[model samples]
Target: MSKQTQETGGAPKWSGSFGFIMAAAGSAVGMGNLWRFPMLVGESGGGAFVLVYLICIFLVGIPLIIAEISIGRAGGKDAFGSYKALNSKWGGVGILAVITSFIGLSYYAVLGGWVLRYIFVSVTGLPKSSEEFFVSFTSSTGSQIIYYLVFMIITVAIVVMGIQKGIEKSCKVMMPLLIVCLIVIVIRSCTLPGAGEGIRFFLKPDFSKLTPGVFLSALGQVFFSLSLGTGATITYGAYLGKDQNIPKSAASIAFFDTIVAMIAGFAILPAVFAFGFSPESGPSLMFQTLPAVFDEMTGGKIFGVVFFVLVLFAAISTSIAFLEVVVSFAVNTFKVSRAKASVISAALITCLGIPCALSFGIWSDIKIAGRTFFDLGDYLVSNVSLPIGGILACIFIGWVWKSKNAEKEVTNNGRISFKLVNVWSVLIKFILPIVILIIFITSNPWIMNLFK
Candidate 1:
């Protein structure tokens, strides 16, 4: 493989394996970890869900990460370009991934804005009523859009700086700080008087709670948390050098992402239980329930700031990856400069996000197939596009591109030794496709309602 990009006047490679791992881990670590994963653990029978989730991460998530990164390093191009380079017909799968990332980012930025607002709110003072504050903030169209734009600008500026200077550097700073903040919160949360109940609730497994649906939920969480089928791993992998070990690097990404998520649960659920709140609070757990928990804690304001800052870091880290996917596609496909692509893509995403921002306010009544714009967009990306892209990627690697070539990429063509290459091959070729398909089918409200 070449050291610099063949196209785009020699685009730079990742600074080193560590930089690649951080960037990829940043992409993998997002709201899915901070927001969704903890909620899933809360609602899905705690330790049982955690156990299934861990198993899925190894069997399914890690293998998919390996597959996506291998494809990118092998193709040495943008996500779409990489697939098109290898097989013309499989190009659409890359497009599916890219589009999924784009749509995901639209609503994702709105949530980032909410985190920013909450960060300020945390500093100012805790709200008497967390639910009312969240509702008021989200319903204020002007405020929501302004915050959304601010978040977009921040993300765009990072992408505009290019990979090493922007994404990698910011992640290096933010990820460490994020981890520290999590640790601090975990310490405080666990020390609370009634915290052990929540800890046990999160840690103790009841095998009887093991159901097929729990496994499916765990699989979906794995896909969402890892940024699988989103063109992120693939795009980041495009910038990786031949010397970097794909399997090892992918493992690091998965490990960091999973650890952050488990830590987030420790930081969150314990506090929730300590404060006499329900664990199964769903999406509002972070926005609504956590603030109330913070309200009750000693030095809660400081911890609140740290927690939201942690959340913001997670949000921005992932948002930049999402934007990079689109920007890289624009830069590579349209043959535009990085600045031009970044600006245009940022503008497009901002525009597209307008309705999503409005979904909580004036557009609240508007529904697409009984979902608000934000809900519908989230459903499509998470349930529809993500699984399709993942399934197609598995097929492309297993049958079309063939697992052997992908294995060669992961092993760096005999330079590196991967003992689990056969295991990864079998998982990618046979297991992941079936598993992700089940996630897709079970994830959909419409489809699942049919059986109900």
Candidate 2:
């Protein structure tokens, strides 16, 4: 808390816990929840996926979140440095965490570009409907690259402005706007004809669809949606004060994140049902179906504009958080200035993002493990980086680090009785590790199809 401790630490303290919460929430509430969650739900059989996803959030997501935050606060450093500082045995894992963040940001920015493109179209009233706009946009290679560049540039510029002025400021405005817009869209969608059916479809738990494949999908969604294993959470936690309650903060973040996702599902599903369209339209569900639904509504154009803007806000906020992990890692490990780290990280990620930008067009033919360039990037991050990073984090916190130290850091001035600590210990030592390992081994395509 002293000037010497603050200055030597070199990381900016969040203005307050609220700013930190919004920034963290902004990171978690991104394209995955808005664009990907509904599609996954539809594909895995509506309510079944939702049920399993919620279970995963509590079982796996909560413990790992606490571990990550505890580690970050304990180290009081950036992602890689934090891990390395914790113990030398974790240096490689720390570096992998850094790699994961960079890899995630690479393709993430490309998709963020797609959202940016849609935002402009929403403002200009071009393409008319989501379906038409997406078809036209994906039909050409040149346009996708141009739009991708625009998105990356915007992301880099914001990151270049430094954390307080750039990342925190943007989230303060964008997060509130995102919530307000989402509320309006949900209200409108609920009024549509046949909206009841859509709500029923989402809420009804079809226990029959609770297959292992569905479970894995839900697990993956929970991890990806929360931006776990990407070091974003770790870096955000590093900015916290000792008095911040780790468990309470994690629960709040998870609650808001899950609620926003559900709200998005509510907003989109009713409209999809009203339009008699399949909700399993994959990633393009939002881009294609929602616009058509809006087009038929009374204030379609206005809502369409608002929705795309919301998407842009979600994408940008998440991207900024993702970029922050890489920037923080660089600054902490190499002892570099924030400006240098930002530019270097941006340039590196931009180069890595080329294939993702071209995945729909020029590099369309490129395939690995039966996926396109973009798919490969996504798979690498979700299946490889995330699960692995999460596993290592759990092990480090539960086993590697001194238990008394971790317990003190996590509990701080607040009293966490032996019983609660025991429960957390059991989770980290037994439940979480085994589950993560099972998911990692079974995440293979062959194993997945066996369940199908």
Candidate 3:
């Protein structure tokens, strides 16, 4: 928690397309891919939900990414700055996006704390029963606070270094490490006895499970998994060079993001089935089930260490992206140094996150609408704020920014064709907004629980 990085103050640019891709992909591939993606696959009925999710990625995700990034590159500023540059009235939409991301980062750090705790214990060796440990550890208020503080401190340290050296550099390192660790996990998990059943359930399509609610789940997954609706891509895109092809780069990021989610499915579900566990286990599936699976392996202690380390890498990369957006806003909007902005953002996020961290332990009894503080923050961001931000963003770019002006950035001054531009234009204007609105309406737990 005490370790720190020397800060250099400025609005730094990304080195090139490669740096941009790594940072964007690292942001896209997070715990959503590793933890929630697999659980959704099981809950939404295997490949049916995956099919809808992939459709959503192309129809919804790619178009939104291109739009947001175009806003950033054209304006050459933070999310709100970008919107203000386009039209002053739309600036509030950017503020909404930043707020949503900040809310997510608050509870997300606490989850990162959980990931860090697992990494720590996995090195020493998990106990005979990890379920018991998860229960005890989450209920220990002091330990939770310590881990959360350490996790937030590390996030702030990285953000203080600015863009190229800080985010791009860290992502370039962590993304590769995460992929390598996942490869090891995949190889080990696929070899487990009865692993084939899990693979079949993951890859084989079963359309009979399709329902209206499953479509909502798929849409929500695409939204959360790609880090859309958060101004992250817009903030990250503000560093893009004029020559970078926005459409092509956005497409590439989505491809890698979907690939990671599927790879995580291979890594987790196979192990779950092999260990005689139910695949339909919810969010706790990753934390509660994985340890038992790891414990039974030959040299499991070593693999457990690698598994949690891999997760830690994902957590850090994702948190960096979330924190970076707020930092960008502060520096650009307030004319503060990166270090100053990072310090302020970290302090604010840490204070807001205390209730979420305590939710698991001391504040468990404090509830709103039958959800704890962590769950409430998570739902507000993922369910309500994000969707509204996305809807407003789509309206701004599609109607106000207009395809004629916005498409300029995507094509890099006519380097690419205009056919795809019109397609993207139609999507953000009509299809994307409508779909996001559908998710916003149906995301209420009262509604979602009915389908479940």
Candidate 4:
């Protein structure tokens, strides 16, 4: 309830935990869940992937999430500042967090541009096919650049408005809208002819297909999907009041994010199956499949427009959160104004985005270890920054900080039984770090295959 001066300090404390939940949900429920989850489920062998993903969410995702949020609340600063504030020795880690987030948002905005382009296309008319549409869109470098600029500008503008007014307020609106739109899409997908088959494909667990690769993929998805790494969660947690219940709020955010992702799978996979298309189409799965379904449905054009609009909302919200992490780091570290920090950060990101944007065109021929600029960025952030950052956060909270101090700070006036704290401690200290490392080691095969 206490108001903080926006210019001199950070935004005011969130109105309550509900606001925090919404903000955290906004960060989590992005293009990853809506646009990417269905494709991953389909490609990774349906139920096998979903089952592994669930395991990863609990074992690795939750503990690390708690650690990140706890660190943020304790430091009361951006990712970099928080680490530096925690210990000067860990300042380099904070810098890595900031840079990782920057790399994430850079290409991430380029993808947002693709989403915006799809939104426009959906309004006008659904594209013919994924490959053709992608080729045509990429061929026109001018339009791609323009769309990328528009997406970046919108993200930067929101960030410039400050957190409470722009980031928090906008998410409160967008997150709910995203949920509603997803629900509607799911309902419509269910009504499709032979939709039941898609449902079975997604929900029916096939234990036989389970493998280490599938488990690792699921874990990586859960970690990346929640926006757990790169210090975004911690930065958001910095705005929380001492009275907030960290465990309960984190659980709520994780549950909501998971539910939306599951619903999205229902919305997408059913339609893909109903249309008699392959779900294992990788990144092109959504682009290739969804448009065909929309083009075939009753009022398909209207539904397509709504779908892409929701996708755009999800992409922009996530991009805004990523940019905020970088902007916050700049402002807190250098003691600069928000406007100056945002502009500087945006300029730097835009420059970094150039290679990512061109990855579809002029830079298409260039490859690092047989991966494009976009792929390299995605790999570095999702595989390295996120998992490692999470590992560091857990170690700091569980081992570096005194247990009594953490319990006092986290619990506030509320009485959390010692048993729960003990459980959390064990998970943070041992289980979570080991799981993340295992996933990181296993995720390399996919990258290795890219080279082979």
Candidate 5:
């Protein structure tokens, strides 16, 4: 319990703030940003959705992230341990966050495998019918499971290298490469013959398209894209150095994450528009629509390869963060070594993910509340666990731990200047909980049905 250990939150203090920032940004910048954000934007009214999403990020996402990091840095422990160390009764909230991470990753890895498979498919050249190819590949239970395990193994291997040598090191390389690839694609997408329409759709607000549903979608995207409500942020915070400015670092992470999401939109939407595809394609936008766009574009095979590779990096970066949360819990709680914890955690998560992969084909009819395993996992995590965890975390900080103390942590015991410290306190303590609760209720079919 030396000052150094407290500051670093134990040894291997992220190399420096830059490394921590990169790793944190990597965690926040995932499929949520790269895949979901663009689809939501396209479906939810493009520029209008983007505007509301930015507002949601500021009011809810950043404050909650700052609060979580403050909790982590203050407790200097894993998510559950951090809460227990701060106030033992609130430990359940931490556990909830960890569970969120676990469930999220279980299904997320399946999608990651899809991205990995697409990378090779892009290189090999997309099939004649992108939709049929997508349906066929996703329905192949054995192929899906194999790719899922392969993705998990790659994730576990990186995590087993330990934080600095593993997560941080990989992110440092991958994030930059991912950004570069995004830039390349964006340029190509924008310069296409009819790309202006897509850019206009993405950047020009259409007020008529704004609705309560669009607002909710934007809110959800902000929350998910930033990796809020998951233990991933708290775990990353646990590795932060005392000298690191929490608010500034959190802002930087949010900025990078949002920028990436917007950039991803530019990369995809322009191409979608140029090719005369529907922007309202939902989740299938990435897998089904984009392949056709690539197939038709000049030199698209090259760009397609680059696009999926970018997505693969994003998928890996986030997967490692998710795996790290579970692995860190095991190491801190059970006193297991990092390597052992990683192997066990990864194995369990891989097994858990199997059903999600199979839900596409073999287990397609197997239903929990009429949802296949993949849909069920997504529902429980996105609609249930994440929102509940987020609401409770806000309560823990704003009430139990006191927003003042959180502010202190963010401001480094008041040494660092936090200009909007008061605003942050109010948002975390009051505004956030209500907003997130609304999102929770509105998102859940069961809850919505209760009122109806």
Candidate 6:
């Protein structure tokens, strides 16, 4: 890391191990893991999808996370700078991660805006049913764009304050709070009438439903949920202390993040089942079904507020990471102030997000390759950029840079056990790329349509 970067409020390491773990977990446990995971589990046949997803997390997510972080910590630089230190062409890997994160945050903010708006109305008492309320709200152009802007503004404010004061502090506060909120919601939801049926549904696996699609869905979820292949871990790793164990930190982050996702499933599945709704309600399960579930309970408004507040915390934590990747790149690459980079990045994302925010309303009819702007962005990041980025990072680390070099970072320069280093290397070199390539191919619309 350059002294110039340190001089400009960009410390090369986190304040402590705990802070790094919390910040990393906060990055992984975002809106996708919370809201999307359960939906995916439901649609993909609960047990089988989850089983594959957990395996994917350990094999793909953990290894890639360790590799990305180790790369950053080794070079002590931004995502691109980290790779650029190794070789100029390797910077392309970092560039892909940044581009993925940039495009990812644009649509991600739009989703955050949706949650923010839902939070407001959850307290106001909707005269209409939850589904109708969601339909009406999403159909309005001005409301959608306004909420999106509001969410982006909040994101920008946090990033501008720098890492320690902003990112780490926020995560330390938000992660625990988010966990508590989810636990409370889960407790309440499980006690509802016939909630046991939903619990059974979630716990039970239909292995017969396993297909190429399920595997792909689970793999993609692991990638998106763990915040892998997005350069976030790489950028965050740059802020990691030299003495920290990359493997342990990566495992802890993945473990805690998986817990949050599971808790979210418990929070929603039982409530929907108790209310006699289908578990496979897809994306609308959160905005449509859960609101009505809360409304039926005593002190529902309070629960509603807490639920959406939990969601906002998750969203903010993720947005901070996405912005940090870009900000770090700008400060190091362009030699700009953190404030300038933060502002420029935020503004760029806001402008790019306008189409995504509008896709539900004014831009509903607009389509690229038979998908809306929001869906298109999601596909590009989740299916295309992410898988390619992960495979490339693995190839760069396992073969190009040689895993022995990364072994030092994982082992803390021989302080920790170096036993698993060989296994990690082999997986990165032989297993991950082939698996990701399969996922990448299956995730395509044409391929997916065939499976359907």
Using lDDT as the measure, which candidate wins?
1
Instruction: Give lDDT tens digits, candidate 5, residues 1-452.
Output: 11223323254567777778889899888876765777677666777778788888888778888888888888878899899999989888888877888888999999899998998888878765998899999999888988999999999999999878899889999999999999999999999999988888777767788988888878887887787878888888888877788888888888899989889889988899999998754458889889889999999889999999898998899999998889888998999999999999988887788999999898999999989989998888888988898898889999999988888789888788889999999998888899899989888778889888
Write the residue-wise lDDT of candidate 4 on 1-452 in tens digits: 34332423544466667777888877888877876777667667677777777777777676666677877887788887777777667766667788888999888888788878887777777546666887788757787788889999999898898777888888888888888888888899899998988888877767766776666678778888898777778888888876677878788888888888889888888888898876754457657678777877887777787788778778877888888888888887788998999989999999988788888887898999988988899989887787787777767776776555566666763454334776777888888878777766666677567667
TM-score of candidate 1 to 2 decimals:
0.96
Return whichever of 1 and 6 wins on TM-score.
Answer: 1
C-alpha-based local distance difference test score of model 1 = 0.88
Query: Candidate 1: misplaced stretches above 4 Å?
Result: 1-9, 448-452
lDDT of each: 0.88, 0.79, 0.84, 0.78, 0.85, 0.84
Which portions of model 3 miss their true places by more than 4 Å? 1-11, 43-45, 280-282, 445-452
TM-score of 3: 0.94
- Stretches > 4 Å off in candidate 6: 1-10, 42-49, 210-213, 447-452
Which residue pairs collide in model 2, if any? none
What's the lDDT of the predicted structure labeled candidate 5? Answer: 0.85
Off by over 4 Å in 4: 1-11, 39-52, 413-419, 445-452
Worst-scoring 10-residue span by lDDT in model 1? 1-10
Q: What is the lDDT of residue 91 in candidate 1?
A: 84
CA shift of 13, model 3, Å: 1.3
**TM-scores vs. true structure, each candidate:** 0.96, 0.91, 0.94, 0.92, 0.96, 0.94
- The digit string of per-residue lDDT tens for model 3 on 1-452 reads 11112222344578778778889988888887887787778667788778888888988889988988999888788888989988988889889878987998999999899988988777777764878898999999899999999999999888888787789889988888888899898999899889998898787777877888788888888887888888899998888877677888888899988888888889988888988887655447768788777777787778888988888888898899999889889988898888999999989999999999999888999999989989999889987888888888888888898877887778877876646788888898888889888888787657667778
Clash number for each model: 0, 0, 0, 0, 0, 1
Error of 4 at 421 (Å): 1.4
The root-mean-square deviation over C-alpha atoms between each candidate and the true structure, in angstroms, is 2.1, 2.9, 4.3, 2.9, 2.3, 3.0
